[model samples]
Target: MSRQELPGLPTEATMLRDFPWVVVRMRCHFCRRGGDARLAVLAAKHGPYVTMGRLVVEFMKECAWAPWNPTRRPQKYGMKCGGYCMDLRRPDPPDLPPGMQGLQLIEGGLSEKLPAAPAEFERRKRVGSDD
Candidate 1:
């Protein structure tokens, strides 16, 4: 099936199917393109990635498409790569299942089963933040 056919979200996470494996392709929020990989999925992957937190950190760590050097961000050296150089891009958070209730997901249609953000006021904000 095409990337669009798969549910949940791309590289960030996907709900485990009855099958053994899943191919993931998460888009870069910056460059807007991403590489694909095969991962062993088990369950829902939670996120506050849009606000850039642990979920974003783990996603970047796991994503094969991310740059290796954390301190020095990528620069296009005229197609030349060196000294931990690689592409620079951030992984967007994957969609959550109905039970967890995602923060910024699009609702209706295919996502009809998905619920709105949590009713508890605290749940609406990032897990740990002064904001």
Candidate 2:
């Protein structure tokens, strides 16, 4: 079915399903700028739409609060599983340090970035260094 068939759903759902990756719009509460978030699903490995839950959890966890749901019971307790509503996963951007907006514009770098692991040398150097 055409995306227009679903009037209530967010505009990104169709694109999300089609692409291995997509730049999602997320609100930045501090700068009032929109952060271009990225999402990907590996259909060959995980099956189409299968990673939606895991991605949802990761999204919520990054936002530092559980997903807020109004329809489920216990209305007082905030947050619930995002379920199939991957579009619903959004955490209001908290106040961030200078230049700390989610994804950043750079002079000599790529527009897209992902969480990275430290270099082996750096990782070894940082061992219990904070202690």
**How well does each candidate superpose onto the true structure, as a TM-score?**
0.22, 0.26
Candidate lDDT (C-alpha), each = 0.39, 0.42
Residue 26, model 1, lDDT:
39
- Judge candidate 2 at residue 102 and give its lDDT: 60
Alpha carbon deviation, residue 61, candidate 1 (Å): 4.5
**Tens digits of lDDT, candidate 1, 1-131:** 66545543333232224222344443445444455444333134442222212234545554434566365467775222211111112223333365675466555686566667756664477778988
Task: Report the CA-based lDDT of candidate 2 relative to the real structure.
Answer: 0.42
- Over all chains combined, what TM-score does candidate 2 have? 0.26
Worst 10 residues of 2 by lDDT: 82-91
**Top TM-score model:** 2
What is residue 85's positional error in candidate 1, in angstroms?
23
**For residues 44-91, what per-residue lDDT tens digits would candidate 2 score against the true structure?**
444455444444344444442344433335646654433233244333
Candidate 2 has which clashing residue pairs, if any? 67-79
